[model samples]
Target: MASTRPRDGASDKGAARSADALLARMTRASAGRTAGILLCAAGAAAVSVALPAVLGRTLDLLLQGHPDAGRALAAAVALTIAEVVLNAAVALLAGTVGARSTAWLRLRGLGRLAAAAPHGVSRFSPGDAATRLSTHATEAGAAPAGAARIVAAVLAPTGALVALFVIDLWTGLAFVLGLPVLGLLLRSFARHSSDSVSRYQRVQSVMATRLTDALGGARAIAAAGTVDEERARILRPLEELGAEGRRMWSVQGSAMARSGVLMPLLITAVLAVGGLALADGRISVGDLLAVSRYASLAAGLGSVAGPLGALVHGRAAARRVDALLAVPPLAHGQRGLPPGGPGTLELRGVGVSRDGEWALRGVDLHVPGGRTVAVVGRSGSGKSTLGAVAGRLTDPDEGEVLLDGVPLGTVAADVLRTEVGYAFERPSLQGATVEEAIAAGAETAPRERVRSAARAAGADDFVRVLPQGYATPLEEVPLSGGELQRLGLARAFAHAGRLMILDDATSSLDTATERQVDRALAREIRPGTRVVIAHRLSTAARADAVVWLDGGRLRAVRGHAELWQDPDYRAVFGHADASGGGGNR
Candidate 1:
């Protein structure tokens, strides 16, 4: 059973480090956008100072018994309008910059994950990866937007306080005195609240995973009469996620409430002091009003601490992205392959392991170039592992796998992929049309070659009957298992590589279509250099040589006719006589 316990200290530390790294990467990736946003924030701050300064001057003009006090009041009003306009412009600019930066970060991070995630990692489920990319990227984006707001909010108030000080230094002193309390609030909230936020994010991931699993296996669950049970299992995680969300919100709400109380209370104190100064004639009424405005400004800064907290959260989220980015990909393969005939394949003490399980044991095998070889094995017999090694999908753990006397690891991956094509047992098609799927990753092949390959794979007839034939989009079209297999075969044929490894590629097709494809492949393919991993005895029986594997080791390599004589071999298919034997290999 899977463990339900949450991760512990070491894991949390690693996650935190990863989150930090993600933020650093986001900073680098969005540097220009950040600069643009900061510029807007600075402008917004400057505009915010205009209103208070102008209002103070207008009041001063009125108090001096200016005959044109009305004009001065009008000027203040106009300045206030101008300040609003400037604030609007800056807000728009900052929002645009933040949006574009988020897009770039999300796109690049997702692309890198898709590319680097295929090798080495064993637990990168599609559902989990999708959740990480989507949720983490969204949370990370909040940092920049929040940072822009925080910069403007902190600066406008701070600038107002400085201006107030220039008018009367005591007011500035009062503003400065309140900052220690604000700092305490920030530190306390951040230290305690960050963990809750991280916890909420983790719960969200678990909920996403469970939801994806339940939806993807809906058919299976219904058929097994476990729909209600599966639904409960998925909903349980979501409930846990909701509880975590509530806890975080409660913490945030309490911190915000305390900050809210402190800000206005500090403003009231400043007002009382300013009133005493005004009554004593130590400060003019205009100066008292300005000091009041500054007090309000400081209180406004306290409110901004909320977005500031969001900025920190966003930075933490970006750290997750950074963790993924820092993981190095497998080194690029060499540039070329050694010149040799197509079929000269050899394995020298090769082995492969994944997550501590030896997928393939140390084994040596050599097959001379120019003949069809069949690999016969039970399920989990390392048959697919051998095919993967031969195709260079992965590197071996212990020893060398050579193609044409050159170690596969030394040959460039692109070249290896081009020269050694794989037709998987259930090939993943990646195109709108049959032709497009066949032409995938084979840039040099022409449309005519794609057609020829389809015909060779016995796929031409069904394709011709489609609404648009080669132009028909695959999305709306339904294909049977056999038809899909034929399409996979068409891709292999179109590739025109020297070494072709078909891993149970014909298993789903009827015997007639299967034989037809086999015959076509035999005639068109370069006569010797083919490896067929098959569960069908009919396919193996036709190969030039059959290498039988059992219990992770190769037990025999001989002609099908010779193998038929072995009682153990015959017994495998539950056959008493050679001619009577017919079953999946």
Candidate 2:
């Protein structure tokens, strides 16, 4: 069944505020690099505007056969060279800033993902997360450089208009008359293209997520004879993506075409007016030449569409990245745990809800130090929820959980992590080698202790047979279900804390291996409170106490021997008699 979490009215507003703050933070972080890029771009723009006027003067000097023609020519050449140098500098600086910004945003996104609660991270598909970190981050990073180009693009035309007005008022007025039309075209393009680009990106993310899901379940799809259907489903979003792409192209193409036509008309009109002015002797030949060039420059303003589009697309991408960053992380506390305390655990009237349904309700239980308690129940009976609360993997919606009289919510993160260890049914051991996986999170453990932990989990023998033994990379060692479970157990055992909660961590192992592991855990590992979520009746029977949960409520908390006396308790394990005493172990 799909779970539904209740939403608060303030959540949307809060998320918007957080996203705005994140955008501001990113802008601040890239400020120094952005400034450098802008300076180079401005220098290039200034040279570009000055070169035409200089060239005009040089042309006039040669036309009149003046002695200063040589100096005028030299000045034009120097300005051209300077423009080239400035442009090269801008390109270098822009690339540098883009790369740095991408790296920075990617790192920040990863950190936020790490800090978020498991459920929050689970909301994003792996493929979607990858796209955000890579594609979206890169696009968003380009905004600063794109913004600098936009400023330069705007300045070129503005500067040209001013120079034209100073040289010849009639030519300048001709150029200015076309400005409103160009502005209108650009404004329409921006509006339509922004929406289209945003939609394209969203559809791309959806398609990637569907493809990833299909790939992960390819074996199941093949077995079910639904490969074709799955493929079709994954590609379903492609049509929408294509439509959006076409819309963006059409908007950009239309704007560019309009600019292309208008630019030539404006330039021709300025030349016609300049010709009349030259004929009437209202302006010199040099002034006519400068005005014509400035008119062409003003027309080039239409080229702003490309950089402006990039800036808009980048802004859209930044919003997507910020959405991920805004997922609220689990709050931690400031107090540390007392040293050397017993691993006594207590739950006082705890309740938890998921998707608007109570997963656990008004439950209370306690375990003395150095004792093993097995949490057993039917599926959806809150066994996992109990274990999660015990270890502070999550907090209860109501009531409180305490470790040695210290509220779990009030315990500092470092102290809580060091004192409470957890091993999941499917552990993600992110390490290069078997040794490293076991030693992860327990980097201070001595070599001997690592070996001892591995041996206790019955993993040392299999690990030793590998090519490099414990040094063998995990990817090189393809492990069976039981072997993988053992490795996970070994890691948790290596970091055995004052409280160890195993959430069905040993379910993959065979009965014999499980027995050996249990014996080793009792004999070798440090004494601590052990809370095991169990399915087999034998596991519960072997524990010091059994916590039976039913319908999100605690049914009983007693020894397995005492609970087994009830027929209903026996039925919980789907047993008529105790014939299959081990409960499918």
- Best-fitting candidate, scored by lDDT: 2
lDDT of 2 by residue, 33-146 (tens): 778777877887788789889988988899999999999999999998998998888888888878887888899899989877665666667777887788989998888788
Instruction: Give the Cα error of residue 100 in candidate 1, in Å.
Output: 3.7
Off by over 4 Å in 1: 1-15, 65-82, 117-119, 338-340, 442-444, 526-528, 564-585
lDDT value for model 1: 0.74
Question: Which predicted model would earn the best TM-score?
Answer: 2
- Model 1: per-residue Cα lDDT at residue 516: 90
**Candidate 1 lDDT tens digits, 83-121:** 677667667765665566567667776666644524433
How much does candidate 2 score in TM-score? 0.93
Per-residue error at 474 for model 2, in Å?
2.6
TM-score of 1: 0.88
lDDT for predicted candidate 2 compared with the true structure: 0.84
In angstroms, how far off is 160's CA in candidate 1?
2.8
